[model samples]
Target: MQGFLKVFGHPNPKNPIGYGIDSVFPQLIADAQCLHIVAGRGFACTILIATTSKGAIYFGRLLLGLSNGFLVTFSNIYVSEVAPAYLRGVLVALVSPWVSMGAILGAAIDNATKTRVDKSCYQLPTACLYIVPVLLSVGLFFVPESPRYLLFQRYEAKAKQSLVRVRGELSNQ
Candidate 1:
């Protein structure tokens, strides 16, 4: 639902970064990171639920929902824009497998920690979630903004740079 809403929403015109996916991608990634952090903290706080409330668990769910939504939507857009035409279909198809891989890993972690009676069971799984955001943040730093997005905004120089980063030299063809 959040993804559906974002599709129709206009980018902030006042943003110095300009508009469209170029502007929105970075923000979405950052929001995902923030949400991940919130979820992690919420999960960690669950340790205190004996004295506190079960509300922390719900808060984590809320953060996870928002985080996963943004990641799913923008990741599709980013992959579509960045992948070469011939490879685009295959690349997009891989997303499902990757998602499954994450689920599998999470399940493995849960199975491994399920026997614990203390906070470690949940805490260990929650701590593992932090790895996704950390790796994503680092990875995003090395990735160029989508050339197609830059072109749409008339940033020709930046678009060229982005293209070169992704595709190597621009052929005369």
Candidate 2:
């Protein structure tokens, strides 16, 4: 399914809607975090409504997929660009392990709630999805944009500021 979606993931050469989305969003981290928050909320809502209807569950899955597509793509690019060269491979590799940890944590939460007779069973598990995005949104405020992005956009001063924030005093290097 993900492989099939990758086809659409590529920016259309003729329309370039995806390119515009990528370029126009000045704050990539914040925007990606926002996408996570919305996706989390959408998943929670979908699960809640899913108790009543099949259609709502399907719709929620669709929304979750869309938001996740954007979040993963943007976050990966942003992280790769922002990370220092020495740590770039380690940081990128960490993404998969973190995803695995999330899966484990989610399974633990589901296991704990599985015995409940009421709606709390699903609600509790679904609510756990909010934790990462909520924390990420707050953390992003402390993070600087990718220096490369700033440089590419021709904001040399801001790029330097971002580099200083990430690399800590370039010192004529």
Index of the highest-TM-score prediction: 2
Question: What is the per-residue lDDT of model 1 for residues 55-137, given as tens digits with 9 covering 90 to 100?
Answer: 75666566566667767877888889988899999998898998899999999999999999987777777677767776776
Give residue 18's error in model 2 in angstroms: 24
Overall local distance difference test of candidate 1: 0.70
Error of 2 at 43 (Å): 6.4
Clash count, one per candidate: 0, 0
lDDT score, candidate 2:
0.70
Give the alpha-carbon lDDT of every model.
Answer: 0.70, 0.70
TM-score of 2: 0.74
Off by over 4 Å in 2: 1-51
Which runs of model 1 end up more than 4 angstroms from their true locations?
1-52
The residue pairs that clash in candidate 2, if any, are none
In model 2, the worst 10-residue window by lDDT is 15-24
Candidate 1, clashing residue pairs?
Answer: none
Q: Give per-residue CA lDDT, model 2, range 1-173, as digits (tens).
A: 23432453344454323332333445654566665656565664656545667777776667666766666667788788878889988987887898789889989999999999988898788766667667766776787777897786557898999999988888884
